[model samples]
Target: MTRAYLAFTETGLALAKRLAVALPGSVARCGRDGVSLAEWASAQFVHSDALIFVGAAGLAVRAIAPHCKSKTTDPAVVVVDECGRFAVPILSGHLGGANDLARAIAAVCGAVPVITTATDAHGIFAVDEWAKHQNCMVLEPERIKLVSGKLLAGQPVYYRADFPVMGTVPAGLFLADTPEKADFALTLCPTGQALHLVPRIGVLGIGCKRGTSAETLEAAFAAFCTRYGFAAQAVTAAASIDLKQNEPGLLAFCQAHGWPVRFYSAAQLRSVPGQFTPSPFVQSVTGVDNVCERAAVLDADGSLFYPKFACSGVTLALACRPFAPDWRWQNA
Candidate 1:
């Protein structure tokens, strides 16, 4: 689902087309009549996940300068030469993955990747990139530079994880016995003490009455999270039976929270293995004994963390994936 926009001049149009073939879901845009490069770049900046400009680095810099935002919000911006000799990531190198995209483009074009990031140059782990790979949200992203600076200075950066961590620990990052001793923490649970990386590992299964109000669903969701000690930000997706696919209340809640909804047919829900609360009324109406718990197990491909909880015609269940550290260090 990564949307990339390839903009190139006449001299680089051929390379752009080849690059488009390499990158799925990418559109190659040329400077056509009545469409200025600046306008095209601005539009892509707002709408796309990545913008690949196959021309001068200065041109790419100028085009994105006006639209430049913080590293967390801006899209990846990469510049390539006309002859496809070199690719350089000029903006949002780690969090937005511009550096990684530039390296991929370089590999495709048999060109060199001009990466200037200190951690990458030194073959050190980039915490933000590692967080993205693990589907975790970095709390206090503005402090990311401070963490990296300490690492580059050979300062200790201890980490404490509530979940089991696999693989060897990276340099400058040690396993802390307690959160108080750690410089950063990783957990699914919410904490206000230290900078934490929260994994989006929860799948929320919802079942609501046809006319359930958004306020009711929102309240139910909050109660579910609070009761289970789950952070709302850690829920990656929502699931339900196909009967609720068009339900306005459910759809609005998911849309507001930026969580994708997955719907399963009644038969599919019935096939999910679990000891769910069987309701004769629900089975008679929806052809399934349970929707919320079954849908959550199916979506997560894992066991449930919390069984069905119902309130005011809104039902919710949560499933979790196995906890494992997504190690990014090469040496590890």
Candidate 2:
């Protein structure tokens, strides 16, 4: 179950008391003293996903920001003024809270739930939630957005695993491995000595300035993949190189994968429509070219997708497959 916390004054605490009735997880409160609110909120941050600060909503946001452990993992922070006048979801709307929590607060406290996550508003199966549904382990858990971003930007998921097997992958999912008779690929380890394949997948793509050397590109790819928890074989497909072939990183990625690099021209990428906030570097690397946008558009045949990586020197994308349902040992 997801966790939540409530920090508020006397009136805010009153509103919180009513709102807490509907919350599924635990909720804690700070007394009138603001000092305790910070301490209580900090301790609760360890386990909560939704934090509702019920006083001066804006001040609550500022107070909680400092105590948040890490932005990514930090619990969702929301602010609702005393008297149940206004409800505002301050942080982590999509991954953890903001929507459901706001709705619950609104229902209990008679306030408005101001939510802004496009996917949630639009009823799209969140990439992270979808992965969980398929029982596929999230390789780069952080890259969950890469899939959604790509889909929002109008890209199909081009997937190529080491083998052919499908259970419930999204639309436009590609089976790039050779046509062969196989139940599943070994995900945990391929060695005969091992018995089970761990639930695993990889999203591979790249971002580089014009003229990045193939060697440097390969190193970056290797490092990125390792950092993101992917085995080389788990890579489904090499996303199309940006139209700029001058990019050695793109070329090197193609050569290393031993696959025909799918190239999406700028016009084609821009033409394939969707709504993702393109990164500045993507605009820079592609020279009016969006590397991830173009790559994902070319890769995604028609699958619900998202972009996973956004780091210096590399703008990578992730393509995933469903994890194996059963892991019985087999002798060949």
Candidate 3:
């Protein structure tokens, strides 16, 4: 569903076409003789996840200047020369993935990637980039600059993780035993501390009575997470029995939070092995001894971090993915 737009002038239209062919699901847009470049670029910026301008860097800057927002929301913007000699990420380089996109484009065009991010240039680990790679939500994204700045200045940045992290720790980052002693921390649960990176690794398994109001479900879910130290931003998905697939409150809650819901059949739920709370009434009605626990760990091998907690006619459980260090971009 990701759409990339390639905008080009007459001099670079052929190269843009080649790039469009190289990148699947990409659209090649050229400035017509009568259309204004600014207007055309503006339209592309609004409609695309990434914009590649096959022309001057000045043109790319001027086109995106009016529409540029924060790195969190802006689309990746890359500028390539008409001869395809260099690919430069002009805006939203790290958080928006412009740097990676530029490198890919450069590789295809046999050109050089002109990445200038301080961390990338100096071969230091960028926390923001790593968080993005891990599908984690940075609660305080501004603090990333503070941590990266420390590393850039040759000051060791301390870190702590609640779960086991594999692979050798990147240079410039040291592991600390406690949050108080660390410069920053990585966790799935809330710590009420600043400079913490929360990974989106929690899955919620929910069961609700029919006709439950969305408000009731929301309040109960929020309370359950708050009571158990779960970070709301760390929740990545939800699950429930297939029988409740059309339940209005459940659907509404997941949809509102942009979490995808996975529905398991009674047989599917029964096949998962775990020590789950069994309810005769639930089994009589749904043909499954448990829904919340089984649904939470259906697809992945995970631990039931939070057992079933019931409130306001709703039952909930939580599961966590195994922690693994992502070191693919350590030197990039």
- TM-score of every model? 0.88, 0.44, 0.91
Higher lDDT: candidate 2 or 3?
Answer: 3
lDDT of 3 by residue, 69-149 (tens): 777778888889989999999887877788888888887889899999999999888888887776667777778788889
Residue 292, model 1: lDDT of 93
Q: Which is the leading candidate under TM-score?
A: 3
Give the higher-lDDT candidate: 1 or 2: 1
Model 2 over residues 51-154: C-alpha lDDT tens digits?
77777766676667777554346677777777776677777664454555666677777887776666556545355443333334344444556656655666
Candidate 1 lDDT over 1-332, as tens digits, reads 26565556666877887887887546565556566678888888888888888888887888889999788889988888989999899988887888888888888989898999999998886788787777788877876777788899989887788777776788888887776876677777755556678888889999998988788899999998788776787888999999999999899999888999999999999999879988888898899999999999999998898899998898999888766775763212
Instruction: Please give the TM-score that candidate 2 achieves against the real structure.
Output: 0.44
For model 2, state the Cα shift of residue 257 in Å: 34
Q: Indicate which candidate wins on lDDT.
A: 1
What is the number of residue pairs that collide in model 1?
A: 0
Using TM-score as the measure, what is the rank order of every candidate, best first? 3, 1, 2
Give the distance in Å from residue 168's predicted Cα in candidate 2 to where it truly belongs: 9.3
Q: Model 3 compared with the native: what TM-score? A: 0.91
- Which segments of candidate 2 are over 4 A away from where they belong? 2-4, 24-35, 69-72, 83-87, 121-125, 132-137, 159-332
